[model samples]
Target: MTGIKSIILAGGSGTRLWPLSREMYPKQFLKFGNTSLFQETVLRCLEVSDISEIFVVTNEVQKFFVIGQIKEMGHSIPPENVLIEPEGKNTLPAIFFGMTEIEKKFGNSVVGIFSSDHVLDLTAMETISAAESLASDFLVTFGIVPVFPHTGYGYIKTSEACGPGYRVSEFREKPDFETAEKYIKEGCLWNSGMFLFETGLFFEEVQKYAPSIFTSFENGGDINEIYANVEKVSIDYGIMEKSDRVAVVILEQKWSDLGNFAAIYDEFEKDSVGNVVYECDPLLLNSDGNLVYSKCGKIVSLIDVKDMVIVDTSDALLICPKSSSQKVKEIVTELKDRGDERAYMGQTVYRPWGSYTLLEVSPEHKIKNITVLPDHKLSLQLHYHRSEHWVIVKGMACVEVNGQQFFLRPGESTFIRAGERHRLSNPGKVPLEIIEVQLGELVDEADIVRFDDVYGRN
Candidate 1:
């Protein structure tokens, strides 16, 4: 474990768990109790590697979530350790980027590749550490011992024993229910998407098997250019399935990818009627085997529902049979096809400074309840088409209109006309809350033009 480093892949959109998870706020950042899945992954990785040796690969949009979550955990990773991909090209490129960075910094070390959205028990770290011994000769992948016939996970077939693990005979895609049962009978392991790789051997395999991906990064001019030219492929397709040196280490740990609502149902505690409820109290008359998640804190009554998934948010609600929960991605696709804003954007949007909740919106005006974190400030910008009226609701606000700066306490108000450069800052220890009303013909986010930004927005 001393020579090992970790790279967390956290760029997934998580459309499978929509209505609760969105493009702007993915499942990795969603909290169940206190810690998020991303935070849980970070904590798991810390068991095997130092904080400095752990690297995270995320896209631009979710980078701040990675940083803010780590900061909240009372630890700080080096700024350079947080690698931002210009765009997502799937797991192969993201892992390659992390491996490339580790090679530059540490040089041919053993690196553990992990998914940011997985739920794994800490006991699995021992198996992962044991795989390090086999990393020099084989591309060691951790495969979970199958507990049931699960159609949601891919399968890895094992050949013979090799150095605390087995040689991977073949990799199989997610199959039908019958095929899944057959796979379990054949003693297949669920592909866990976790790996321990020796950088030298990893590079060699990449160069030999995925030459195009190899050459694109090797001849890199710019990060954006490299990403643009790289193929969008998963590591399993691009490297693992084709590599003969692949080894499988059996991980007998409590694990779940939580890919869909049904998977989420498996993670939580169930009631007397076999129902799982989160964040809301639901009246169940004859409901059984149902998952009801409501963020709006509304009273939901189920009379005779059974094996159903009911997820309610501020802007959208999803009601589906538990057996068809895997088809949630199709709903997201249809919403995108219909050009619905709820497909990507949630009611509450998080930013580096803080977050804003859309309270009301019409054709003529938009209302938002904004909260600025302590010592954080918004960008100095102006909206060409919208005029904003801000009323301080909590804490203290330092408002800047044009070049003039003034302080406003709770219940104080200010107005910024269209095309006026303004900024809002929280100068107090507590969070600054305000009611912002925007009036204009077009009051969308794209109307903003920033003159200055601390978080590097253009």
Candidate 2:
């Protein structure tokens, strides 16, 4: 446990738990009880061993969410350890990047790769430690004891037990209902897709099993180049399913991948009427087995719907049946095809400094409520197409315009002219809230000309 390093793969964008989890912010950054799934995974990694190091791999859009949650979790991991992937090449590349860094810093330590969106029973994970410790010459993979015939997950067949772990006999792809039911009866384990490995062994297997990925690393794991050549293959296809040196550790743990509406509906507490309501004021007249979430703390009423999801956010409202929840991604794809921001972002867009919620937007103007954390500063930027007027309403805000700096108190207002290099900073300890109004002939967010950004935006 002393030399164990953890790599939490936090780069999932297709997770369809929308309204709460979108393409920009997936389930990894979502708060379950108080802590997010990613934060809980990091904490669990700590408990598994005295984690020597931790690395999180995610894209730029998700970077702000990851950074904010990690900061809020109050871990000892340094800022430099958060690896930002310029572009995503699926799980294999992300895990390989972390493995590459671990090999650089601490050589040949046992590394555990955990998916940030899983709910695992910690007690069984303790058994995983023992299994990994005793595993010989194999990539140790944790397989959940299948409680039901799930066709969504792959299955692992093990022939013989080899000490604490079993040698993986074969890997089965997602099967039909009958095939899934037969696999469960034939003692096949649900491929948990979680793996633990000795760093050296894992890399050796990667070289032998996935030469494409290994060769991609030859160019210093340049993510853009990796994405250019690499096929859209998951780690299962890239390594585990093909690698001969693979072993399975059976985990009799309560685990679930909250990936879809059905899985989410199964996890919540339901009432006598069979409805899972997250909102306090949700009036469910006859809704049975429905999952409703109100992101803006507004009351929602489900009159006569059955087996549906009613998720109301400040910017979007999704009302669909459980059977149609999977089609929500199609809607997202259509939105992206139409170049709509609704596909990737919410009204409250997160930034490195803080967040800005779009209160209104029009052809010639837009209004936003910007919140800046203490000591946080916006970019030294200028809008070529619009002038912005800022009014502070919460805390003291320090503003800069045309080389002139001034402190603004609550109830005070200032205007930044177009093409003027200006910046905003929160000087107070509390959050600085400002009402920002933009005006121009053709105001557009794309006209921003940032001279400098601390968060490394171009």
Among all candidates shown, the one with the greatest lDDT: 1
How many backbone clashes can be found in candidate 2?
0
The predictions' CA RMSDs to the true structure, in order, are 0.9, 2.0
lDDT values for all models:
0.94, 0.81
Clashes of each: 0, 0
- Candidate 2 has its poorest 10 consecutive residues by lDDT at 127-136
Tens digits of lDDT, candidate 2, 198-314: 878877878887888888786654557666776555788888888887888888878887767777788888999888888558877867888888868677777778998888888
Encode model 1's per-residue lDDT on 1-458: one tens digit a residue: 46789999999999999988999999999999899999999998998999999999998889899999999999999998999999989999999999999999998899999999999998888789878899999999999888889999999999999999999999999999999999999999999999999999999999999999999999978889999899888999999999999999999889999999999999999999899999997899988999999979789899989999999999998999999999999999999999998878899999999999999999889999999999999999999899999999999999999899999999999999998999999989999999999999899999999989988888
After superposition, the stretches of candidate 1 with alpha carbons farther than 4 Å from their true spots are: none
> What's the distance in Å from true for residue 56, model 1?
1.1
TM-score of each: 0.99, 0.94
